[model samples]
Target: MTDVPRAVDRLDDLVSLDTGEIDRTIFSDQEIFDLEMKNIFGRAWLFLCHDTQIPKRGDFFEAPMGSDNVLVVRQRDGSIRAFLNTCSHRGNAVCRAEEGNVRNFMCTYHGWTFGLDGELVGVPGKSIFYKDKLDLSKHPLRKVAQLDTYRGFVFATFDETAPPLEDYLGATGRLGLDMIAERGDMEAVPGVQKFTVHTNWKFTVDNVFDYYHPQITHMSAFSVGLIPAPPDDFVEGGAKSDTGANLEVPFLPTDLHNFVVVGEYGHAISGPDQESLEVTAGTEPFAWRHKPEVEARLGRHGGRVAGHPHIFPSTWVTTNAQLSLRVPRSPDVTEIWWFSFRDRNSSADEQAASLDSQIHFFGPAGMLEQEDGENWAQSTLQTKGLKSREIPQLLKMGLGTSEVVKEDGLAFMDAPINEHAQLWTYHAWREWLRNPSWEELRERTIPRDRY
Candidate 1:
């Protein structure tokens, strides 16, 4: 393990909240990544396998917890548990497969066997070879500190002191999950779409709130009609700073009516205001949310905000009925996992239609991510260069220009397509990297005048 910096007080030097300029080294620094794995990843409640993924007893799913992998298993009592995959005798993995139903896990290296509940059950030639000196009870795989489910979604954390799953989710995080949970009996698609994108995980995370990039980064998406753009001289957010061009695209309208919600403890939601979108595009993108019950559950903020919602760390809920986890392999490598969802209550045809839209937009074969991956890869490369890294990355858009409006136990600001969410995430990222107490983290991440 790399030596972590003790002087977290100096975090402001790396992440400038005042100037909205972040030092580029935070993206690719080995030391910084080490700190992140220890503080951010270790403490935050990370998304694990969905409850639907391991429905049957003895079924399991291998999930990433930072650089470590854990086996999420369903026990005989119809409960879920997660444990480290490594064997106690040797560090070799007991299960080599990514996921499946198994009665027991026998390590290939030494044939030490573990039960479905991750208890050490057998060791080959224990009596003959070691006279049963080793205590099998002591050798059971190490379990996570906490495991819980909300709306059939499983999440675990290594911090015993961490808040309960629901409290940790806060208003922002719940709404993110509600985007799918409210869809009337949802389940994870049979197989997760897993792929690698050569970018720092932070890029993928902050990009979720980045509504500005779509029209430009994914212009091809609009050109090819992957994203339905409105017709003619529609303008949004006044003007694009780079080209000084208004939203004058021939195909799509410019008014996304973007909304943003920043929550305590680093959770945030940002994207096109779906209601405004339905009006401008002459289509109802989020018709499902109109139900009175769903609206009551979503509250005012959730009901009106239609866009991508990102929980702290790396869980992203996109508008196209998908939940994505950007698992960090290292500073420069991230594994993207997509869990497509459908309203199980809907007819087969409706589910199929949802799946078709979901697959084409952002999955492994999705046209949009292919473009995003290229941009994120190159953007990461620029940060690795010695001289190039000295230049600060700017998150100045709408920086200090908007006031946070408080409502329904949440804080947010409505702006004309700005980087407030991205900058807010980084601000919270720095606070998390400082390894503050959970209370302090929640306090630090509260919405402010500027990100």
Candidate 2:
């Protein structure tokens, strides 16, 4: 086997857990991006299409795995499997469409075809083609090392030795996913929304746990009522000013506490605790979780999730029942795919409202993400400058002062507005970039005694 380059040695300098400092080069360096594709993206259990997406026989969705794409198909046996979209013969894509129902994937190139289970079953002019030297079975698409589902959400990984999906996710990660699953008999909204954003995938991942940005970056949301106004008014005198609209609403007091859960393998859940969020944002979005039945269904930390939860590498689950995949394309480019979910049993109006919220929240035309993309893009651009990179990126707020607590089988901290979650994620990011053994990686990322 030709050896892979030594990629972990420089990681120590790139991120400093002790000081909560991260070198900007990791976002702009070609070498670091290549290594990430090999280590992080190559081994992690990445989210594929949800089971509801390809429920019928012969259904398939072309999903991205790092630089390559895979065909995620539902076999006649009702089992789901994923395989490289490339034809083994000449490495040409076997399926051209993003998703659809097909009896088999036929490579438009040389006409090699694969079954739903990824078996090589057909080849044009087989007998006349080089005396049929190619063993038909040997030319099958490359299958993922592991593919599994949790509550209908499917995921696949390229590392055979990696831990089982459940253990890898741990309670913290699953809790993030559970919030979406327990929202009734849910199914992904038809048609995924995809668009390219000029930014490092890490920026998107880290932002999932960011409660600090909404007040500033999403000001329009508050002003336009996308995020409902709080019950109490703190605007200079609890009174609307001169012209009309409540323009001077008070921001979450600088002291608003945020809760967090940092798990092994770099996953995290962070945002305001249940009460704080209720106090700031409207209660309608979260009232369901407080129902006795819903709380029991959620179980422990899952029930208490008023925060944004992020699965390591790049899968983000928001309280709104939407999932976003931040796919890394290059050091300075990332493609985002959005999957929205709604309850099947909900009234038509309810589902329609969910879809409308989903469409206007974070996809290509979403007002929120459009603004966020600009910041991420500019952030990535600055990293490419020599002098710009030297200015250390800081994530030191609430670093050592916050106390972590254990509850519902999770280790987490709840504290006033601060950078604990972002810093924790970067600390975990550094550990992943080290390319340590799974045991060591898990050991390194276990939540600290304090933030």
* Tens digit per residue, CA lDDT, model 2, 191-267: 99999999999888777877667766887887898876544542222356678656564454565667788888888
Error of 1 at 438 (Å): 1.4
Q: In candidate 1, what are the lDDT values of residues 208-261, reduced to their tens digit? A: 887667767787888788776654555444445577776543333344577889
Candidate 1, overall lDDT?
A: 0.85
Q: Which candidate leads the pack in lDDT? A: 1
What value does the lDDT take at residue 184 in candidate 1? 82
Superposed model 2: Cα runs more than 4 Å off:
1-7, 229-252
CA lDDT for candidate 2: 0.84
The Cα RMSD of model 1 versus the native structure comes to 3.3
| True lDDT of residue 316, candidate 1 | 96
User: In candidate 1, which residue ranges exceed 4 Å CA deviation?
Assistant: 1-9, 236-255, 449-451
